[model samples]
Target chain A: MATIATTPVLPATTRTRRGHAERPSAFGTAILLLGVVYCLLPVVWVVMASTKNGSELFSTFTFAPSTHLLDNIVELTQYRGGLFWLWMLNTAIYAGVGALVSSLVSALSGYVLAKFDFPGKGVVFGILLMGVLVPSVILAIPQYFLLAQIGLTNTYWSVLLPQLISPYGIYLARIYAAAAIPTDVVEAARTEGAGELTTFFRIAIPMMAPGLVTIFLFQFVAIWNNFLLPYIMLGDDHLFPITVGLSGLLNQGATVPALYTLVITGALLSIVPLIILFLALQRFWRVDLAAGAVKA
Target chain B: MRIAFKAGALAAVAALALTTAACSSPASTGDTDGASSDSGPVNLTYWAWAPNMDKVVDIWNKSHPDITVTVNKQDGGDAAVTKLLTAIKAGSGAPDLMQAEYQKIPTLVSAGALKDLSKLGAASTKSDFTAGAWNAVTLGSSAIYAVPQDTGPMMFYYRKDVFKKLGLKAPATWDDYAKAAEVIHKADPTQYLGTFSSGDPGWFAGLTQQAGASWWSISGQSWGVDIDSAASKKVASYWGGLVQKGVIDNDPMYTPAWNAALNDGKQVGWISAVWGPGVLAGNAGKTKGDWAAATLPQWTAGANANGNWGGSSTAVTAQSEHPQQAMQFIKWLNTDPTAVKALAQIANIYPADVHATDSALTTAPDFFSDQSDFYQVAAKASAAVQPFTYGPNVNVAYSAYTDAFAKAAQAKQQSQFLSALSSMQSTTTSDLKKSGFSVK
Candidate 1:
């Protein structure tokens, strides 16, 4: 049965690949190349700009590389006694812990909604869908007020707790759970004397591993790049994420010159972790695509 | 199924309980009283953007162990004020003190974000600052809202090499300034004397202040806005005429293009402030010794009138639990001889204290190393600044100026510039009325 399920997916994948290989449209290729350049030019500009010192930044050619990348990094690191690193660490904690906990919650709620029959389930899911429709930016001010009332506005929890319940993540998980976890498999685990929690942790989770990875990466990148929530919630520079910290460096008021070189260099360094994360988790995405094809 | 439902419900309740528990514990620990009991050491947080301010505060922290202050560096004026107002409205998380721009004082005070320093015995420091600087914080009232930290007495910065090559001297009058603008632009089409920056309403405000125009004034409980007064119109049309004739550039300052213009000497002059040297040295390092500072050109020849461009004051927040301690730190930060010297040397600000000249400012800033009497020119200009009052709707007026004059500057029309002033006046007055402040 497993062989039968897997065999058809192979031909479907190879056939699409062969079709693309045979008739590659020039127009389509050119459009995609345009998209690639559009996406990559700013990144290239950043990489080139980061290498220049303060004077060379404006004087030299826009794309020309210089020798001050290391020096710029040193200056940025030394700024206010390595405050850049503190912001980096703070960002990591917010994104890492926030995404991890959020994904787990998403998984639990998603599984229960997908596999069980319960009263008021539709209402719960509908409210979540409504939440997904509401932009998080609109909620930031209200969330700030809520956090302020509780005296948590400047704390890490102010940023963290508001992000713990991502409706879109839960919605994605629900859809993934319904598709990935077969009802028969859940029943078989129950018949084998597994409790619901044990069944979830053992059989269902392994089956939903690829989907959970997608949800985790989504939440991770979303929280990592989030600016407004943290900017509004936190006041202490020590607790600020990388986005807000770098912004402060650029806007040092009218009297002082902005640290343009440091900001550019900091921006370059900030993206390194995100790139590394994408590269590491990219294989799971490929696996997910193939798994979806087989299941279908 | 029932058990699963029960488990999920229990988890939700537990999560909520944990949040409230975490929140309530911190709430209880915070000091709620307005009075400074001073039972123990006071920990004050200050939001400021001046560079190396932490080092300046370090001296105070070392000497005054009982009331240690932490400086949380923030972004420049508008962002800091916006954050402060948000914190004030939220009823929590505001710092003990904030660095407020001179114009922002009225807005902050009207919002009740600031404590009246007059109540905190800050009135005694009045002699330390110039009348113009002092009046900005007091807003023509007895309530002292802030203590002036730095003053940006307006000055003209020109490239000495470029001026000499063009056979021009620093303009002594607005007419001479206009003639020089034409001469430079006629000599080199790529160059102009200076740009009309619609983006900076404060810079425009300063120019008008030099022309003896006060945009807003308080009488009784009402505000009288005269944004389009004769003095302001004279200042506006003067620049507009030059921009229309294509003798002056309409591009704004503090941009990358402007920085490049300063570096390569494509732009010969800048109408900047006392702290212009730091910006020049940072942006145009190649043209360091080539620049010179002079007083702003007068409307009438030999007149010594000037205006302020950018400056800030240290203000204690109304939400501060220990107002007395916060005021003490602010007083020391601005008026103390040791602290003022540190502000000049370490923070590189043009200290607002009149006594800053006697000891701290013995030498010129590095960019003006050749101009030995730089601060003397700045001091003269500082003393000459005419008092100008800012209203609670200065932000609305400023943004209106940007919108209206940006079009005027773009069209390069003298008429539009004059019309823009009227628009700013109307917008400002209407906004004041809408915000429940009586306007005359």
Candidate 2:
């Protein structure tokens, strides 16, 4: 069974007839490895390229690292009175709070739409689905205009408030809540003299914690990676996220070539936190995936 | 849960505010101590994309301490324009003083985004600058919108070494230029005479402008669109013929391939503006001291006429709260010899003010190594650039025209080029009309 190479290796190894299917196919592994390399090539390039000084950046081969990483970081830190750190802090606030609130709202709404029979439930779900289809680029300018009407254009609320109503997060939450939590448990909690809200928070929420974690992670990464909304909403650079701040740096690099090294180093520094975050939250993601497999 | 989420959001906001205060508090990126000092009678925000403008602005601030002009750097041309547009539509966040490219002036003015500076004593500076530079910022001969800042009269920059080796003289007319293209390519098939990019409408507009094609003009009260004129079509066909024959390279400029081409002497010349010397040195480093500058070849024999490519003017926005102080700074920035001299040192282009050309600045660019006498030729060409008015939706028309022109340029079809020209004119006209502008 271990030597078999005729078909994809399957997890169901005890069945001899389908054992070859359980084996990982070389072609699939090659494709996935290629995907991983494709995703990481830019990260690796930034890490290595940030080590070179100004003149050496253009002169050297891209993958070759030099000894200017500390110098580059120092320059970036001194850039605009350490504004790169401000961008990092702003990004955390925008993504962290935005994801937490959005997940809470999505869980509540998704639980209601999934378990409770309410008027216009189908209409609500249809609208949520339609929201997922509408592109964010189209929404961003109009959002800017609407936010402008209330005098909140350059404020933190402008960027955070729009991202909190992520329709995709709600859609995922609904499917996950319906699959992960059983209706009998909700009825049993209600029958035990629990109110609807109490039943939801006490028992159903605990049952759906894995699903909510998945939603939170989804919303977190989405809000962190968002560029256009922040670029449009914020004029003050101090309020800018790392995406917009690095973009501003990269754009200015055309005139000032030395800023290119700063941009590379800034980019490498910006991603480390996100990698750490993904690693920290990765266990819940695995559990969610396993729960999803059982539900499937 | 809802209350907890609110608390979390509030806590995050509080932490961010603390961080912000720890690092300069609203003046993080070079506001020049306005909020802290609180001394100026008027505080004006200036949005400009030019590099090293702080020195120029700092000079002004030192002389006049009553008014403080805080500099906000925009990254590029398109982003700044988009930012301005959004700010104008939103009716807030517009900078008091912003540098607008000469071509974008009309589009911005038509949108009623810029303050009419003619009333603000803009007319007094009219005699101080060239008509080609001054006319770009003036609207309909009465209302001026911006101060003339810089000019980019097109000049022929060539590899002097390559031309000498090929026994080629600088072409004096468009006919001679076409002939030289054929000769250059026939001599060395691997190289092109020059790049004719489809992606850049500015280069095309400059050529058409030099060809005596006025793409638009104000007709009484309504705007006239004439991008499909015979003169423009003729210029298009001329480039099309060369592209079809494979004599001219169609690669876009400022890319890795174009840089390599210029560096390796694969492209013999670039018909660029006063900024060419600086850019050529910056990008094509290996070709130092090998290049020389000449005025663009005439459309008619011995005409000595040229076209302008890039220039910008500083204007006061309509949203500006303090227009008087704004104009005071603007006038001094453009007219004062001290400020202009400071600007010319690092600006890398010919100064728009006629008085700004001092002897020390004219010696030679280090990149050219004094071999070419580039500035003298560039100045002569600057005077010859015919006055042309850019249309009111200039940037919008450019994006649409670039797309259609790219298809035509790639396919090498004259009819396609003409059709694209017609469609561009029609679409721009109707779109402007739909946007409530009076179009003829």
For candidate 2, list the clashing residue pairs, or say none. Answer: A8-A21, A8-A23, A9-A21, A9-A22, A9-A23, A9-A24, A10-A21, A10-A22, A10-A23
Candidate 2 Cα errors over 4 Å, as ranges? A1-24, A27-93, A104-130, A170-209, A236-239, A245-272, A293-296, B1-40, B62-65, B347-349, B413-420, B433-439
Q: Can you give the lDDT of residue B301 in candidate 2?
A: 93
lDDT (Cα, tens digit) per residue for candidate 2, span B118-137 = 65688889887998888788
TM-score of each: 0.92, 0.80
10 residues in a row with least lDDT, candidate 2 chain B: B11-20
Candidate number with greatest TM-score: 1
DockQ of each: 0.58, 0.14
Candidate 1 ranges beyond 4 A from true positions: A1-23, A287-296, B1-36
Q: TM-score for chain A of every candidate model?
A: 0.91, 0.87
